[model samples]
Target chain A: MATIGIILFTLVVTLAVMLGKCQKKPLSNACASFAFNTEMNNLQGYLLPQECEGYVAGYVNSGQYHSDFAVAIEAARTYLNTIEADQDGKDLIVLDIDETALSNMPYYVDHHYGVETFNGETWNAWVNNASAPALDAMLSLYTDFRAQNWSFAFITGRSKSQYNKTAQNLYDTGYTGWKTLVLRLPDEENLTADEYKSKHRKRLEEEGYRIKSCLGDQWSDCSGESAGKRTFKLPNPMYYIY
Target chain B: MATIGIILFTLVVTLAVMLGKCQKKPLSNACASFAFNTEMNNLQGYLLPQECEGYVAGYVNSGQYHSDFAVAIEAARTYLNTIEADQDGKDLIVLDIDETALSNMPYYVDHHYGVETFNGETWNAWVNNASAPALDAMLSLYTDFRAQNWSFAFITGRSKSQYNKTAQNLYDTGYTGWKTLVLRLPDEENLTADEYKSKHRKRLEEEGYRIKSCLGDQWSDCSGESAGKRTFKLPNPMYYIY
Candidate 1:
């Protein structure tokens, strides 16, 4: 009976040790996948879904996002300082509109921070309002480059139909002296942002403009053919564009 | 005297309101710049410095880093599934070493989580130990693709002298059936990781290998000519490599 009790005790202790080992093991692929999907879903909208609204809000409110943006802009400035403006006035810097030059934070705040699926009508109305505030760091970059006699071109995903309002907004927000503001035309709406932006950039290069730097919140704005000599990506954990 | 007292009270109230407004103002460019520089300095090593050690430790300990890595690998797998492996066995997937293939966590933990500048002697000793564990997700990826008869080429920045140890470490960690393992040669030591890796990728393409996907923890691993049909970036907030 004593020998039997010793055997049983050993078995019990061994099983307990095995269970503890299992508990301490690293996360399996399934658990990791589930967590990733949850994070991605929260980041699905142009800003953030309701579940992660506080996180995004805190990122902005704590000023970390602004600091990150400043870092990117600083890197761009460092790179741009190395290139002399062409004597032919062909040196150009490309800018994207939304989340790059302008902040749609006011609209997003009103729309559940983009928890709602994008509504074309509401977005168009917001654009027509022409009240978006300048992203201050970008405005400073634009103003500094403009003072240095560098040409600027704004290539945006905003539709050409809203050209009047977009131009009005740019002017009101302290942006001026840009060589061109290229907006998505109705015929080109089917193209991806990358495709459309690349087409416009190729055209700009053909027009004898030497793109010195490209700045955008999305990779689409800074990728593809003729994407400028240097590209700077601003922080936009809100949404992704292919 | 009563009139003077009322005027003074109004001025005091106005002063308090202005002070509140000043306190609520956004971070200035100077403040943002300072914050950015601090963050960059902390990320100067191959891993984080002492100040941000807890942040990185928490990220890894919380398993969020693993989840993010799984997400990237899942994306790559999704893309790869669409491409059929070539009959001639020319289909290839490229992988980066270090944080991508092997977990250096054990070593980093011992070295202040990389607060210390990267020490070649210590790092080489660790490498020669030939005991680095496989990044489990990557091992699963290797096994899965190997079963499908797809080819893999590991292009690592590890020196050629450590080839035997690296090979033994990889094999012991369940990685097998790789078509080639390319390490940095002595003459190629001066080249940037990007330049050296790109050169090898170009050579692979020249050898008629079709690089369907590339995966790495750094942009330098996935950029440059002949990168791949698709590139997936794994999370590595610990450091930045040019």
Candidate 2:
């Protein structure tokens, strides 16, 4: 009787779980709300005006604001392919790391308790905290570009020593799929972030990569907007370099 | 009051489900009883003899089988670095599709159901099905290798017409995150799968890729065997070529 009872219990439990999962309102959809800690921190128009040009409004109507980034990514892909490829047949899209590919808004809002800026030490601390999520538009853009054989390169102001940490952090933060993720190094030290970035972007082009497009919250990501390519901007009013 | 009641009911159900998940075994622990479906229709050493010896096993696991395939991926700084360069500056480890990186065992086993031989049309049906999981050891191997800077190149047996289907299937079935994926093309029709694969592999070598390792479940994957590179080998006893 005990053995029979055990079997019956298992059957009931399995069925219940499966049935629950199939239901439209599955139990505990509560934590579907479990977005990144930095998801909600982008108010105050801290993002720059040039980056702001990309916002077509109603970006987050589904409450996720998927389109703002989706349109941007699709627009970038359409525009990016025309750039000539070097011998290697790669189309490069330069991207920034912070609120660009990932959302640091929640950390700033909650952990720093409304602080609007960053330093290396604090930024490193947050990444090590490993609590961010890939921003929607960026994730979509990365996947779409990859599907089309275009490459997305992350050229960030994050210091060089944190390369592994940053990479691992990105993976942990659900930015796992991108392959060409580059970080800033101190040989990048004396150079302003923009200067180092411009040099590297040119190097990437010279090395046979057709850098078709550039995306970022910072001017440095676009080589300080000096490249001849067409640029699509996103609004990052929450934070920008003067 | 109704909303409060709903919340309370949800909390009770949540506790029950949490208990269930906690009691449930880890995904890793669920392997043994997991029945597989190999897509290939052959069960009686289904691959051709040379296909087994010279093609699948040879190039698929040629050279060193240590974690290099997974290790080399860690060196990828960006998609460009992953595709073009490496840390020690060697871009190696060209991966094979089918049983090398992904387990086609389940799909293969199904096509051979109640029989002990290989059949082509049934294999085609399975290819149409294109459902297989990345085996656990290989997944762990890949994740670890990607951490070690061993860049990966995926070459598969499905023809070019099957590229979109194959890639989507891989993405759906979890054989994803590869930087470079190549498909088998049946269009030319003049060359055998073996000759076709060898030429492509040679082309890569000619392009300056210092391939440190090759992996696949068929001899054609290691078409380098005649060249004496003797690529790595992994066991596939459930399906063999007579």
Candidate topping lDDT = 1
Each candidate's number of clashing pairs is: 0, 66
Q: After superposition, how far is residue B137 of candidate 2 from its true place, in Å?
A: 68
Candidate 1 C-alpha lDDT tens digits along B101-201 = 99888898887655677789999999999999888888888899888879999999999999999999989999888889999999999999889999999
> TM-score for every candidate vs. truth?
0.79, 0.35
DockQ of each: 0.08, 0.01
* lDDT at residue B11 of model 2 (Cα atoms): 54
Model 1 regions lying over 4 Å from their true place? A1-50, A86-88, B1-50
Write candidate 1's Cα lDDT for A65-110 as tens digits.
7777777777778778888886677899999999999999889777
lDDT of 2 by residue, A1-242 (tens): 55545555565566566656644342221111111001111111232233222221212222223333444455555555555445454666777787678877666544332233456677678877767778876776676656666666677777777778778767775565564666667566777766877877777777767766777655445644435355544433235542
Second chain TM-score for model 2: 0.56
Cα displacement (Å) at residue A239, model 1: 2.4
